[model samples]
Target: MMTSIESTPFKRLDAEGRLLKPAHKAETRRPGRFGFRGEIALTIDPPVTLEAAFATAEDGDAGLSFLAGSLSSYKQLPALVEALGAEVKADGKYFIYVSDLDRASRYQINMGGVPLYVLPIDDTSVYNELIDFLYLDKTKMKKFDTAEKLDVIADGAAKYDQAYEAISYEEGLKRL
Candidate 1:
């Protein structure tokens, strides 16, 4: 059952597990299972406020506020969130976990007929930490693009020669 508003480009999906067709970037779409949209690592200026980021996701049409608590169960979450320890507000609330925001953005874009938008707050340290945590052991889950491949290559430089040697000449040439 497609709503009239879902006709918008960002809201379009070919099937249950297919990628949402955004207005731009038609070539980047790839079929994915488990409603895993994708993750974006934000870099901000001064004055960072992650809770505001969560609030933005919450205000999205997908009603992402509901997913906040469940995110505590995601992999790597306990350690990261627990490490926050006493840094959180007196209310003990924050958008420290990226999984919730990522999932919520996916939900809105794929199922709620909403455009994807995330406001980046200022705080490179937190942003860097989020990016690092989001992609931990991520190769086992998602395919990497050229830039990401470069990142992997850079991060795994020690294994580069071995990885290259493991591939046949023809395969290496094809990759090149």
Candidate 2:
């Protein structure tokens, strides 16, 4: 699976669960999961498209979703897609929810060589909200170096206690 295209240090993961390997600072990979001890939460952007959402939700192998219909079925999903009501990130048909921790051990089953990130929105739930991003280790996932900032980490902060190296698309080119 290794290749020259993935060897560049700038490549990295974006916040959309996609690979941007060779990505510079400020660039980010997408998140894969957001759950508690046995639960998770997810917040997808707008461009993913509704059909894509359904495809993501219906894909039996993705293992990221179970059977969420609303934001309140946390106790219903077997172990594929738990639902919650605390989320609020949807446009026309998109929605957010918490992963049922009890039934979330399936995420690792189909991750397909991607890294996962977890951020703390309230510190109390470090493994449930504010996902960092998922990507390939050296090629697609290791772009930002959030290890030197003091303000990037907010009140709750991520569990790592280090600042994420975030750079804007414009500033990223400077390093190239």
Q: List TM-score per model, in order.
A: 0.18, 0.18
Compared with the true structure, the alpha-carbon lDDT of candidate 1 equals 0.25
- Where does candidate 1 stray beyond 4 Å? 1-28, 32-122, 125-127, 135-176
Please give the lDDT score for candidate 2. 0.22
Q: Can you write out model 2's per-residue Cα lDDT over 27-123, one digit (the tens) per residue? A: 1122222111111223343212111111111111222221112123232222222122212112111122323222222121111122112111222
Model 1, 1-176: lDDT tens digits are: 32222332223222322222222212222111011122211212321212212111111133221111122222333332332222222221123333323332211111122221121223333323333533445444257653343233223321212111232223322432
